[model samples]
Target: MEIYALYGPSGTGKSTSALALAHKYNINAIIDDGLLIYQGKKVAGQSAKYEKTTVQAVKRAIFFWEEHADAVKEAINHYPIERLLVLGTSRKMIHRIQGALALPEIHHYINIEEIRSSAEIKAALFDRGTQGRHVIPIPRIQVEQDFIHRLIAKVDKIFSPKKEEIGETTIVHPQFQTGKIHVSELAMKKIAIQSCEHLPFIESFRKVKVDITNTPVVEVDASFIIHLGQNVNDLANTIQQHIYDAFLEFMDLEVEQIRIVVSHIQIESPAHA
Candidate 1:
């Protein structure tokens, strides 16, 4: 089925526009994460953010989407009685999604203008707008500045926020674990999962859980294995790389020694992620 993706920074009204269009088109339902109801059935949303509640929301939307996809294609002669639409971030992402679904091009709805103004950002944050879904930090794009600057502008509202409170700051307990410490395997595992927020492939990161009872070492279930757009080998390497990157962030330790524990690949995004 073709997706008229509504991609924009935090509160670009993607969901609203999707619904309005759906109504105007007389199509069955809205296909993103919210306002999902068509013909008394629900639709599915994206699943990159794997929180239980959020996943349930996406799955709910997906069911409705899958159920209505074909009907949508057949019922609405013009889909809009005027036009059809597809939405998402860069044309690159939208195009990728189009090919994946064998969908025709969207009528085209690109709105980076919302991202250019911080005023818009604030409104989106409070209004519960579409919110960024590309889900990658600025520096993470691995692209040249001009392009990176533009992309970052579009998705800056979503990032791994720094931890801070009041004027008082607490220490991060142990800096390093060399000889032996009370760091439980479960603790380390928990740390890894928590840190996944700091990198890309947030969805894929869910598959592997960590265990530490194995002594100064740790057991990891790293299986990031889907390179949407990147060097296949490089993509594999990145999954491990970003995990370790997140692992270190979670460690929050100022240790001199380093231990790299890699298990397997789970899910993979493109190189830019």
Candidate 2:
């Protein structure tokens, strides 16, 4: 396979601009932060961003674990990829990744400064330093299964200069520092409750259980009473959709499973003459 490298310092928006660059060069796949992305989907390997500490994160990114390296290598060999873009914080890092994956010498090297303005780089640095947010060039659903629960995943849309939609990216803050931010169980339940309240057919929620046990992958169990004459199955589906959308759009949390159990049905009586 022909290998291309995008090299720059950390927190310089390389991942943010990767999709646009890939599109510009007609590259079919990308290797970023220990994940393999093709056609805007994550097809192989776990993300280094899921590591708990900065040291571990770095190691994971460089393919320190044998299993991680083997998995990515195997995927690369299995796919019919002709051109691949490898992202790294420096040229040396790119070489390490290329060697680890057994890829051929990089045909070209593209610097972050070449594609992004200084102001853009500064903004990305500030966000990384202050908020600890990192961008992954794959859609949220692809990584939601393995992403840690404490981190939030926001969908980021990238567009070319011509305003053509390139692809979707995900922003997440990994647990690489002490005193990492937490999304409380109560807060998640509140989101679920609010979602249920907005549905016209839902009279009131009997219980809203937000399960964060597996986290970043949440399971919601809700019990509610619906207004009479409403199609039970239809309303249940609507409620599920609303809750799913609310969590993803508002909280950036992925809801893996939503179970709606009808506890009661309320009906209004005819007025007396």
Candidate 3:
């Protein structure tokens, strides 16, 4: 079987990028944290994130137990997995998993830095360290089947750059993680409106809405009154990009869509002739 390995330090977003990478490379299966995810479903094995401690999680991730390795290996064989992706913290860890499953040599190695920018990696690490949020590259339903007790949230479906639907990711706060924080819709709404501050063309906001139902992925709708004679298309695009960048920089949230509406044009009153 053709194998690919993606490695980075823990919490650098390997799992978050897994489905997209797999879709990009046409890899049909992923071995992530002791779970065998095939075509966006968990076909076999337990999630290492379900463990009670970081040490146990590490052991599970590496397939320390013979039974765990056997189950995943059998599942791999059952499927026509022409190519597979394995995620780990480093090359050594990937090799351990490869040896445990007796899988073929890794034909390609991808670094998380290649898939994500430095700023993105920093944001991911902040989320892991401060928010205790970890991503699993499977649907929320799959994660719920095994770990319903822990708080779970769904991210909006991931899409490739060409707009192909890759898959969904579930946020799992591991048992070992502690503390919980919440960001309300009001805060997000304010951020969306505030993103327009630097643009002189924007006169005032008519309406602002933020959707946090999707957890880490947010949707913002903003309607604004703008100065007349400004390029509406350019202004809308600028607002979209500004808000999208703000969410990432300030909240570490991904904006799935930012809908910009030019509600009314504020034309200056003409002096009496």
Best-matching candidate per lDDT: 3
**Runs in model 3 lying further than 4 Å from the true structure:** 180-273
The TM-score ranking, best first, is: 3, 2, 1
RMSD of 2: 12.9
Writing each residue's lDDT as its tens digit, candidate 2 over 1-273 gives 778899899988899989999999888899999999877788888888888888888888888788999998888888889889999999999988877878888998999999987546755664565567888888788768788565665887889889999999888877774443556768878887787686655666766777633233334444445445546888788878878787777655456677888776665433310
CA lDDT, every prediction? 0.37, 0.78, 0.82
TM-scores of the candidates in the order shown: 0.29, 0.64, 0.69
Candidate 1 Cα outliers beyond 4 Å, as residue runs = 1-5, 24-29, 33-40, 43-85, 112-121, 126-273
Candidate 1 positional error at 146, Å: 41
Best by TM-score: 3
Better of 1 and 3 by TM-score: 3
Candidate 1 lDDT (Cα, 0 to 1): 0.37
